[model samples]
Target: MEGGRWDMLEWLGPDASISVFNYLDNPADLARVGAVSKSWRKFVISNQFGKRLCMTLCPEISNFTHIQLWKRYSHQNASPSTSMDWQILERAHIAYTYFAHCFLSCDSDKDCIMTCIGASSTDRFPVESIHNTLVPTDMDHMVYWRSSYWSSAGQADPNVQESLIYHLKRGLYLVNEIRIRPFKAFFQVGDPIYSAKHVRFRMGHSKF
Candidate 1:
């Protein structure tokens, strides 16, 4: 409050505060404001402000879920930049929904699901290998989806399904060999509206 206009910042709503803070060209300035108080900490953790800042600074991020979620949470008046393509928006929405579901599952422990949402290359990681090779046979965990690649026919291809199942099975087997619990894995190929150049992949772990 000494050297900064703290009173003005305190007057703004969460979204507006973030917008103003981000408008400052210096990252150090943003950090200073963020260190103000517990309320500010909450805003930072919730991504209420950082996400908006990102969207405002980089229009491309408007097509990401974190920004959209921040907008929805804050009820901010900001709109997606005019430059954002509708097709990209649609795909990002779908991907966000899938990720939201996965987050909910993780939070509730209802499904014991952990999702990996992103391009195909992004989701291709060895979980069992990372987890010391522990694999559960009965419980399945791991859903894969391709949001960028969709069939011209509008339905998912049998080949994609087969490939998902095969890799998932292999992954499970690797886990099993290490005595790890198996969690159900699901792979989705998201609709074309959400992805163009890259295929999105999602993974879910089920409790039952």
Candidate 2:
């Protein structure tokens, strides 16, 4: 009976429901929960879901910093998306949360030397452009690279493989998430933005 009652998520109340939701580590799980009901969807969108993910993954991501980030970017000039777009907000929160969590986790271990493994894209607009695009940066302005080759950059075409490989400088590190930002084409005067339909990452000590 207790288990059945608990399963009635609506009974959890706004506060309790949020507490329960916060326990979820997977971003996809969070998104799925919102689809369960209209109330849940509202609750998920209103709450700083991304911030919660970061806090759960790495407690060091202080509430202050997270709040400031929300205050600044949460309402700023969203180039690719509208400022009020919930999906965009969720995406930003998740990405930043991961970035912060990784940064803090790396710092936690004194012995861990967090160094950037050079990234090599299958093809770039110019040689070595990958270096500038993928480097770790502050919360504001994530670096991005646009593929120069039209053939390789086409979206939803599996035949076009735009691969990016990052070789770490020999150290054990815990990787939680990677953020990939598609160019908004904000540079050109009202050009359409292009993004990959699918993305995959592989990490292990082995030769494929």
Candidate 3:
């Protein structure tokens, strides 16, 4: 031992130490490990444990080819040719670490939907627009409340279908469960609730 100090990384070797670190799913634990010493911090950043952990939690994150850092963090004077290698690594480390932290600490129970993009078909323009579906429930009244619920255009054939698109809230890095509450038309004569028999969800970045 050098100066009677214990070095776990030295004792375990690179491969074994990496395996041990890989088992840590918690981002906070990894941050603590990096805080242990300079060597530990370098090891964590060099191997990109934060990025790996993020990819493990959300596989879709791997699809990101590049991450745009905030303008405040960017060096105004520094050009691409003049930028130091260590500076780039530092930025990457920060980005991945933040991404992992946000993913791990996210509130899964909270609603992620931000805004209604559009619907495949609406019975009426503003009256039965998809935006009305955002409301939880309608008031107990006989008259139809245009603001309370959304209605799709009636389809004669069973083969015809309708769909909805919504933009999820920003900074919602992980989506655990998506809950859809179908509106029960208490205002209608029969109190019929329109809902799909089988629901399918598609997730991806917007083309726009």
Candidate 4:
């Protein structure tokens, strides 16, 4: 049985030991290697093997565990360049924002809500007229809103009034609510009529 195990391990290829050690050095590699085979996937996730895999593949993983993995790697490896670090941080921010948006927009959840509005104006009267015509006559602006399950369940407070005020001050028309979720809602705001198209509104996000 030991000889059989040895032969099987041998059959895993000449680089099998290196591959295993690589995973031990940086477990993040499992993200890619996991797709290779069911046996490999099992090996990657197995507690006895997983720690080594993480150590082996830690250099490459970029999902939610990126920061922690990078921090550990940095202790043993040269610190990454500032530009690379910034890029990673930016990507993490985007991921967080995306997750937040998804959470707040998921259906049947009402814990948070968001609203937005946008508008534009042109110098040429004729061009402005044409643009207005393309938009709904009744809607010189657009608005979107979403409510999360938690908010609806009374577990959290709503900020509909503050959101409305913010948009109105910027001369944006509130079109409608786009989505609602447990964490957020999105709304659309339009620019004020006769405002120059070049005069972009200073848009921002605020928790209400």
Best by lDDT: 3
Candidate 1 contains a number of clashing pairs equal to: 32
- lDDT values of the candidates? 0.36, 0.53, 0.74, 0.33
Candidate 4 all-Cα RMSD:
16.9
Q: Report, for all candidates in order, the number of backbone clashes.
A: 32, 0, 0, 65
Give a tens-digit lDDT track for model 3, residues 1-208: 4799989999999999999999988778888999998799878878888888888988887887765566666646556675466556656666777767776675443677889999888887887688877766535521354456677887988678778889887542446667676656665799887667787877776554
Off by over 4 Å in 3: 1-8, 11-26, 35-42, 45-109, 138-146, 206-208
Of candidate 1, the 10-residue stretch with the lowest lDDT total is: 170-179
Q: What shift in Å separates residue 81 of candidate 1 from its native position after superposition?
A: 36
Q: Give the per-residue lDDT of model 1 (tens digit) for 2-105.
A: 47656554677666866665565433444566567746644543543443443454456455443232233331432556234433343333333333333334
Model 4 spans with C-alpha error above 4 angstroms:
1-19, 22-24, 53-208
Clashes of 2: 0
Question: In candidate 3, how many Å is residue 150 off?
Answer: 1.4
Tell me the tens digit of each residue's lDDT in model 4 across 29-147.
Answer: 43455456545543444323433332333323223354322332232333456366544543343333233333334352332223323222223444323223223222323323211
Candidate 1 segments exceeding 4 Å error: 1-19, 25-29, 39-47, 65-161, 164-200, 206-208
Candidate 3 pairs with clashing backbones: none
